[model samples]
Target: MKQICVFILVLMLTSCEYFNVKKTSSEAILNEELQTFNWNDVDVYPTFSVCDSNETKNEKTACFTQVLTTHILGYLQNKSIVVTHDVTDTISLKFQVSETGMLSLLNIEADSLIIKEIPHVKELIYCSLDSLPKVFPAIKRGQQVKTEFELPIIIHAN
Candidate 1:
């Protein structure tokens, strides 16, 4: 009876180890979370103060676009650009908004003809960007993140 009791106690202690759950490492959990996370999507887009905060994501986006376009167009319109030939082209502006809400030009895509016609076109764009209203940085996973934008502006001057 004494031997049987000892064997039973040993079996019970060893079986407890079998029922223990395996602990997951923090790095493994973080890796799994990152793999499931969508890197391309943002929780909130960069916005201007003029944009309504209560609006939906799509509305906020539209307001941002409209405000940005208006500001650029207004600046361009104020400039006295005189072209010899009827100039019509689409200018692609690539820019970035930093995590701190600063705007910086990345690249400008314009036809050679447009460049020839408006020698200071790049300068004008830079000035316009500099004059933009205060912007709010985009948010991803509750953290401010930098975002890049490519805007196409159609220019028609006679």
Candidate 2:
């Protein structure tokens, strides 16, 4: 009887041994990775992947501005995109993201052929970072969080 009990105990221990434990669901994993996705381009700031701690508002603003501006300049620096030295206008870009968290290039600059083809520019990646997913990182009880951000870009040619 003692041998039988010992055998049963050993069997129970071996059967109960865990291989691996997965607490997070598939949806949770997909959502987390989707929220923290990295872009193909490295110049764009304010990306979901480019959050900087202890950064001042001015620093953030400057970083994003420089990123977008440099990208645009790189696209139009020497290439044959003719810009009117006299015509200067501030074009506003707005987007309406879908439930899947994607930045659809909603508004287009309908001024010229060059303007319309901006999306095709090698460096011209849309503001994917501006439209962050709802699954963005949430601050803990004592952690600092950014409440609001204005992802605006301005282009100038002179």
Candidate 3:
């Protein structure tokens, strides 16, 4: 009876041991990393050289927008787009700032008539946007990340 009890105890202990766990593949790792992260809100807003000194988040954002607007407006002053028809609309520009403080144009929203009237308007807008000064990207959880913004360009013609 003692030998039978000892054998049962050893069997239970051996059975409880875990074997080699299933190894994950590279594809599995990639898929696991494909989880989406929330980019709509960030802990730190993007900052410019002049705006970095601001103490509050709202202040910094306001300064950043002001500086960017000034830069784009300055660039646009040198270029002109003609509107053949009487129209009043806003051109929405979507852009992304890279993690390394570089700007890139993503999409532009404009009336088809505007595009037909001024075919090169897209190029002109891009040139203006590209000329903006470098700015630090937004940060979240101590890591720098790309940020997106939608800016509108109002067009009122008579």
Candidate 4:
């Protein structure tokens, strides 16, 4: 019977593995998602009360940077730093903002010449960061997350 043969062929094709929908386990799905997720990128950057919260990502970043730079420069400028030699170097300052909005200095990288010229530079930077205003932690997936920043501070002293 032609109808019976057609039904048999259809049944055979449906029974093949290629036609079956595979079900993935939740754990496997989660693993895949984690693999594809970008850990370095955050949905929202950390902000200060002075920064506009509704700004775009780039604007938020700029606001944060400007605020931080202003505060640090202001603090440093208040102190009279006298250097014997004309020194021009960049200091790398690595710091972190905790999930609870606490700022902590991780490390400071400065050239030997700069360090020799300004022996108390590290202490000044530490004190400056300690006096920073309240910071808001970065947001990732609507959750507060800790973030690290490395800012280069150029020192030009004659």
Ten-residue region with minimum lDDT total, candidate 2: 39-48
**TM-score (C-alpha) between model 1 and the true structure:** 0.87
Off by over 4 Å in 1: 1-18
Per-residue accuracy of model 2 over 9-71 as CA lDDT, tens digit each: 999888875755658999999999878764321222232334355266456546544554455
Give residue 147's error in model 4 in angstroms: 1.4
What would the per-residue lDDT of candidate 1 be over residues 77-99, giving only the tens digit for each residue?
89999999999899998978999
Question: Judged by lDDT against the true structure, how good is candidate 4?
Answer: 0.90
Reference-based lDDT, residue 94, model 2: 49
Better of 3 and 4 by lDDT: 4
TM-score preference between candidates 1 and 2, better one: 1
Candidate 3, superposed: residue stretches over 4 Å from native: 1-39
Clash totals in order: 0, 0, 0, 0
lDDT tens string, model 3, 5-71? Answer: 9999999889776664788999988777656556578888888888878998889888977887677
In the predicted model 4, the residue pairs found to clash are none
Give model 2's TM-score versus the native structure.
Answer: 0.34
When 1 and 4 are scored with lDDT, the better candidate is: 4
lDDT score of residue 50 within candidate 1? 83
